[model samples]
Target: MNRGIPVRLPIGRGGGGISTIIIIAVLFIGARALGIDPMEILTGSPTTTTTSRTERTAANDEAMQFVSVVLAETEDVWNGVFQAAGVQYQEPRMVVFSGQVQSACGFASAASGPFYCPGDKQVYIDLDFFDELANRFGASGDFAQAYVIAHEVGHHVQNLTGVLPKFNQARQRMNQADANAMSVRVELQADCYAGVWANHTDQKGLLEAGDLDEALNAAFQIGDDTLQKRSQGYVVPESFNHGTSAQRKRWFLKGYQSGDEDSCDTFSGDI
Candidate 1:
């Protein structure tokens, strides 16, 4: 991502999740061990303060700038796509945070990975996840990181098109397995949309050699099956919320090759 005008938003703090009872218990135990009053720890009210910006390392700062640029590019591409259909594109705000953040959907930790909260029409991310993507997932490179942002933005596209709510409603009436299947479709579609954005970027000569490979490797690395196998030592096909690595790679390539949104449809057909 070459330097582009960055969209800087206020970094919010004090998201509400993380087991309050467990946290208090730990604090109480620690206070007792230190000969301090547990009441002081328990009675201290949490103060609400804004974190306008988070401290960033040189690498993190560079990644943030790159993500900002990629986001701008996605906006340009999707805005054009929406305009072509005579529908207005509402650009989503990106909230960059460290550790944990509150979202309209709920509180989330960095381990939750990047996500789009349709409730607020915002994309939340922690740049440090890029390090995890590389070090743990073994998917590295600028385009790989850009794909993560684009995929979340893709969910925003789904929200604007009313796909997300419809799917959520369908999921509510479904069994766990069926709902997970629907979720896989939703996720794969986002992956496809990311590729659609990549198609546009490539047309503008923004892609370098190995960029597509990086994005594809990323899609493979994060596939539900791959993640599950590594964590659980077994694969449960019915529990997969995202497609398999092969499926992810195929769908992404389909979108990249066709460059047609219609071709990217994962519903009303066998996936």
Candidate 2:
């Protein structure tokens, strides 16, 4: 492999849905995991909602194994990182859903994107989003997909440490711009966390040639600037909630390079 970044990823092994009567998994901040009866998240309104037809194409099947391997890697890295900090790492469930899924947060379409629902302490992802990565986001490659999952897992780490709840609470009274700015920090830090995971797997000798660049490309591909530029004809700094391409790439690279959690302080980093 070149002494610089690589793009091809090493092999890795690696959801949803329901309507009104769906019983889904849920997570409590300081308590054990809970199950969400779709009825609860929807309030007293008894409504049965149908999912987007659970279709397990070859893509969805392959995406599952891929994410599982990535999650295992994250478990290894974060366990060590949290251990080093004298805390125990709590392993979070990374659920792969096709089409639509119900969570404590509510029903989410694949277009709603991958997200970590703090209430459930689980990472939700629609495997078809992988194609969205390649076709729509221009972020093709398994490593890139792994990066996306790792980023969501990072939020679980943040939630365990109280960072997420703090942000959610803090954002309640803030203006949209300021809230988005805060979101950018959270997302960037998540990117950094993904980087940290990469560094760990690398140290463990899992990365192959072109893998890092695949991740970097994927990372760069999903930035607010790139997405916005693709969707809208322009990039708006004020509307950026996930940082620019440069910032996302920078934070992920920072974590990958340092392999240290201290370097992921996006809250203080300049955009």
Q: Tell me how candidate 1 scores on lDDT.
A: 0.70
Top candidate by TM-score: 1
Candidate with best lDDT: 1
RMSD of each: 15.3, 11.7
- The digit string of per-residue lDDT tens for model 2 on 1-271 reads 0111101111121111111011112111101222223233222212112234646566544444445545655666787789899999888765566667777766776667777788767777666666766776666666676687788888888888878888877887899999889888988898898898889877765665666887888778777788778888898989988888888889999999999888888777475
Relative to the true structure, candidate 2 reaches a TM of 0.79
CA shift at 236, candidate 1, in angstroms?
0.5
Query: CA shift at 181, candidate 1, in angstroms?
Result: 0.5
lDDT of 1 by residue, 80-179 (tens): 8998999999978777777888777777777777778787777777777777777777777767877788888888888889888787668778999998
Q: Compute the lDDT of residue 196 as modeled in candidate 1.
A: 93
